[model samples]
Target: MNTAINSRIPVALTIAGSDSGGGAGIQADLRTFAFHCVHGTSAITCVTAQNTLGVRRVDAMPMEAVVAQIQAVVEDIGVQAAKTGMLLNQEIIFAVAQQVEALQINNLVVDPVMVSRTGAQLIDDDAVKTLCHTLIPKAVIITPNRYEAQILSGLQINSLEDMQAAAEIIHKTLRTKAVLVKGGGMQGDLRGVDIWFDGDKLEVLTTKQVETKNTHGTGCTLSAAIAANLAKGKDLWQAVQQAKEYVTTALTYALDIGEGQGPVGHFFPLWGLGTGDWELGKKQGSREQGAG
Candidate 1:
């Protein structure tokens, strides 16, 4: 809203699908980054006919075009951090992964978005191989909701124990830096716990559940917010914490827009009293843990 004052916001890149409903995918990433005063760059992998409730259809961009978008930005203005979501096909996945490597980008956040909340699968089963092999290994953080973690690691996740087990399986098998196995899918009375497994130790973050149906784009927002904090120089643990806190606050202040699940007000800090700068909790002379 105040473009003049925020002209030179720090840059973050998001490679994902286009959400026509503006509740998820590229739109949510951009809004989340802008909320943190980070300039957002996007490489739209596909276009989806989607709303708060569900996805009606999805049309993917060609591999050539997807590669071109990443090249067009990363090679030009450059980026401090990047996040990926909803890479529909294998071609686009390979292209984006190669570009991230070729561009030598760091602090990359990967949200393995396979299906929509409404049960429409966005990614092909074949693409899963390419995504796990090509992209997962290079990412600084991987945010996989319960279903996604199960899919990636081939582990049955029914509890926090299962989430922790799956996180290790993913990390050891893929060799990615850190994995955040989101506990949003955990069963039973103890649910709001999200597990972030660094290489050596596991960090458990829990919050009270906000009983709202307006939780669309939560995964995308969390991963993008982590990338934004990484761009702002927070290490992996701090960034993850910052992202979790932001998501909780956003969910608490949800606008309840749209007929189905609504979008979080990523601009909460701008319009309301948002939790601010948790990475300010960082101690002096801190460092990241081996690229996570």
Candidate 2:
């Protein structure tokens, strides 16, 4: 109960599912927060049995349990910012929305996890409706990947122009403060290009694409970094810009573990005294194998 020390450290909350894979969801969120020096709190909406390969099973928490976790964190530790991912159902979505309003949680970032980067819809129609109507509008910003942007804006995204259009449509319809239409699922020149649209300004944000299959947690890491920056008192634009940079650097040091796609190195700065020589080692190993 030392208010002095607690007051100095910024606190952020991630109301997301638990990924047993340790690659995405709450796991990624917490790791990103720690890398930013923010205190990370979590209210797990569900538990997933998964790994780098794929998710095997998912079990959602009860609505009441989710609500209680939010209340516990907000009332005691105090959250400066928050983000949500994988609400899983209408009940959890409705509950989270109500809690966001009731707790007056600001600096909220919503990663609309209704669709996968590969264009598969994860949530049902009812849950999607509830999220768009009740939860999304409460967010300061919503980060939606390519397919999710298409679903929210009812437009196809094939080019930068299409991404800009989708961002505009999503901003106009969802009424969120801003919309980030992600292009991670895109191809060729369009990949790694994100479109940002606030009510007054529309900007194209781009970063160098790291060519690797280990992009499993990029979305979660990006949104969580945004929340962490917000908690540290950065404005929305600065938070977003810095977060994108962080994610790109993380991708550069993407971990090459597991049988399938791995995760970006959330602790890249701490990797072997900041040398990040593991990446060099990986490249050397590959070249040696080819030569043999």
Q: Best candidate per lDDT, number?
A: 2
Q: What are the per-residue Cα lDDT tens digits for candidate 2 across 175-200?
A: 99999998899999889999999988
Q: How good is model 1 by TM-score?
A: 0.87
Overall lDDT per candidate, in order of appearance: 0.81, 0.90
What tens-digit string does per-residue lDDT give for candidate 1 at 1-292?
A: 0112234566899999999988789999999998887889999999999887677998989889988898888776778899999998888888888888888888899998875533355578889889989999999989988888888789887777888898888888988999998876666654558887877988778876766667788999999999999988889999999889898877765656778878876765555235443332121102211111
TM-score of each candidate structure, all chains considered together: 0.87, 0.93
Regions more than 4 Å wrong, model 2: 1-5, 274-292
- What is the total number of backbone clashes in candidate 1? 0
Question: Which residue pairs overlap in candidate 1's backbone?
Answer: none
Candidate 1, position 214, lDDT:
70
